[model samples]
Target: MLNQIPLEHILLLSAVLFSLGILAVITKRHAVVVLMGIELIFNAANLNLVAFSRHDPQLMQGQLFSLFVIIIAAAEAAVALAIVLRVYQHFNTANLNQIVTSED
Candidate 1:
């Protein structure tokens, strides 16, 4: 039932989503928006992995690895957010440029 949709459609959507993710990363300067972009990228990767898994039934590695990737990404996001919060507390700003200084 799930195979009713064409692979081309799936690939196209994945490409669009991936491009949007790249755009988000490039356009957003806020730390949280950057994190959201990373999440989008991770989601696109998972979608591709699942699509490929559908093609090759003999190996479920892609799906499994994707799950691990999601887990790692979540952990990374948590740690990153924590660090961002600390930076904000210390510097009172989340802008990347504001955090940098020639003195440092």
Candidate 2:
């Protein structure tokens, strides 16, 4: 069933996901939303990797790389969320623009 779908279609979907992720990251101010955008970008890359890997089932390099990316993304989310929590405790807000530091 997967072979019937053209690579171009999968690539197009991935591109759209990437674009949306970029837009979210650039336009949203909430830290959680930004993290979600980052996840979207990671997912887009994973989709491309898996799509290409489907063509050659023997090598499986793309799938392996995608798995690594997933692991890194999970760790990143944990660390980033922890940082965001600390920032919120200090600033009382999660909006990036609203968080400011005193020079003193």
Candidate 3:
């Protein structure tokens, strides 16, 4: 039943998600929120990759690529969160703007 859906629909959904992620990353000032936005962007790509993979019965390339992307995103998130944590400890704030202005 899933294969009956047109690729356009999936692509459209991915586009919207990707756009929202861009907006969040651009507007948010909090470290964690910006990280969430980055994750959203990753998820949007993953969705498109898996969706395209589903279109082919024998081709698993897209799925494999998405898995690699997922692993990379996980590692990026962990490292970013750790950096954010250290920033918070040193600056006593999670707000990006505040952290920037307070730096002497």
Clashes of each: 0, 0, 0
Model 3: how far is 3 from its true place, Å?
Answer: 6.0
**Candidate 1 wrong stretches, greater than 4 Å:** 101-104
The ten-residue window of minimal lDDT in model 3 covers 1-10
lDDT of 1 at 9: 83
Tens digits of per-residue lDDT, candidate 3, 1-104, equal 44477889989999998999999999999999999999999999999999989979699999999999999999999999999999999999999999999945
In candidate 2, how many Å is residue 79 off? 0.7
The candidate that wins on lDDT is: 3
What's the TM-score of every candidate structure?
A: 0.88, 0.91, 0.92
Worst 10 residues of 1 by lDDT: 95-104
Q: What TM-score would candidate 3 get against the native? A: 0.92
Q: What lDDT does model 3 reach?
A: 0.94
Candidate with maximal TM-score? 3
lDDT of 1 by residue, 1-104 (tens): 54466778878888888888899889877888888888888888888888888788899998999999999999999999999999889878888767885133
What is the Cα-based lDDT of residue 91 in candidate 1?
A: 79
CA deviation > 4 Å runs, candidate 2? 1-3, 101-104
Candidate 2 lowest-lDDT run of ten: 95-104
